[model samples]
Target: MRLPTLRRTRTVEPGIVTGTARLDRRTKRLVGRLRPGDIAIIDHVDLDRVAADSLVAVGVAAVLNAKPSVSGRYPNLGPEVLIEAGIPLLDDLGETVFQAVREGANVRIDGNTVLLDGEPVAHGVRQDAETVAKAMADAREGLSVQLEAFAANTMEYLKQERDLLFDGVGVPEVETRIGGRHCLIVVRGYDYKADLDVLRPYIREYKPVLIGVDGGADALVEAGYTPDMIIGDMDSVTDDVLRCGAEVIVHAYPDGRAPGLARVQQLGLSAVTFPAAATSEDLAMLLADEKGASLLVAVGTHATLVEFLDKGRGGMASTFLTRLKVGGKLVDAKGVSRLYRQNISGSSLLLLVLSAVAAMASAVAVSTVGKAYLGVASEWWDNLVFQIGQLLGRLF
Candidate 1:
């Protein structure tokens, strides 16, 4: 019986992710407070690339979404970004997860289930690279339907904002004198940092009136430049940027409800309100055009259809119409950076210097007066070399 003793084999389970839960319905606001190793619980449906990028930037342990990350809604780019960054994404955990899980509570994710104190609180489908790819492929099939909705929304926006769009009726006057000067409008969109870096020469030469919209103001400040004007709903821009001495313009609702005005007032900063139905990005362009800017250069603005959809709002329709209205004077910063690269390369510059030196030396050798000057220079060099040789010989 003692000789019959045997050992049983045990299979190893997959790794369980544990972290402090941080919940917010708004992904943007939640990201501000997220610390590394914290689990972000959000309700963002068809999460956009910007939000995903923010989450990845914050280095969250995992993402637990209450809604579908990809709802077959025109190939939203957020979920893929999270997965590509190697962040764990648990999708569609339902709204009850908000009730079951308290903020700041330590939680564990085992497989597809969320655990609080070793008890399952919520469950969802764990997403991987394969799942995200499949979802994106399915989402592409629904693009036509989304396009139709976008077109209808565009028409509605046109009807509502005809006066402001055509006549610039509600645009506020700013203290910054933009008349006849090139205006640079910045939005905190895709590849903004790279675009701003390449435009340094243009910024120095043209000295465009810099305008930052919402979080774009922070972008400008981060890039080592001061904004001449800051415009937005004031939700995202920091208090320090508001006090950066830029002329502040608040984008208000059509009904005159300026929610961001109170925050600006609390900071003791004076800002003019432009009450319109358009987004802050559109409002900035409208103000620049109305104020008689000679050229409008846009940076980090949504230019493509997918980008517009990624905004996840009906207001993006306003952007499409805004582009059409300001197309004549508008230029994308990416396009400008591409077309305007440094004409002089270092190798070519060195070659040019050598060519000039050769030409001067040849002229000096051929001319009588130049020959006399060269002889004097050669004698001086010979005397210097003789002095150096005598000094070296004495030292040795």
Candidate 2:
């Protein structure tokens, strides 16, 4: 058999870039430790927008991906974004690179070749914006196939998760009360910060039960709110968020094999395990709806087709079903700020200012010292006016 193409070598010269190799299979966890000018090694396929954005924020010198940056599966916007940001992307480097290179080892990348101690250890295809753009253009042709596969997956998901959609069978019982109160389920997704900022008033007024999904817990903590419950696979969540005194519920597969539970146990923390086929966000909504929450507000939830695709989700059936179950009581935070009538109106502000002024005046009126000062000021004002008038008459 003919040898498979190793890499599409490029002639464009990339000057030597030296940095420590920080490797992690999970992009989210790896991004936390990435420092500026470090070479980021990741195994993420179809690199999502969020991960790409995080890597850019970390200012990595170059990215060495063990997997294909663009598989022509879809127009994954990540590789393009990285290339456009002038961060060199080297892709399709064999998985052996991870084994051969140790973490924190100083490595040199000349073009797509990774050198360890001046010895070539791995080779890959150098991706620029032109190449990434071409790949994305080609990937668009496969969109129909992707859509078909998505439909098939969604159908399969619907059959498997019917009980979760209708009866809410897998929702776990928690101490956080949701009955007859508003519930805010925050997911760390599209424009989540802005959404939270917009909902500040609602959060303060209603005191909604805060449920954070994985990284969203950290977002809540950062925003000066303590989450009532933290739910998700514990992979992306930080240890500090775990110890934030929120009740942690680890998500697991239906078979009850919880990968995240081990991490929780390692942290010496107690967590409830909820096993289901749906995503953590779906489970959060189900829990709130089943718990008799009067209203449900969502922040950073991926609602659009592009967003679902950006998440590299094969299908959005779970989200669709979850929305159907909770849509009546659910309100998306994207437009909540526009719809929510502020309790503080212009009239209220004017009234408040008037009330403050009247209170101050009343305090001054009741003080004998204030009366004496006012009298003195009044006499001074009259004397100044008379002096000015006499001077003006003399001049005339």
The most accurate candidate by TM-score is 1
TM-scores of all candidate predictions against the true structure: 0.87, 0.82
Model 1 misplacement above 4 A: 1-15, 335-381, 384-396
By summed lDDT, the worst window of 10 consecutive residues in model 1 runs over: 1-10
Best by lDDT: 1
The RMSD of every model to the true structure, in order and in angstroms, is 8.5, 7.8
lDDT of 1 by residue, 294-345 (tens): 9999999999999989889988999999999999999988555566656798
* TM-score computed on alpha carbons, candidate 1: 0.87
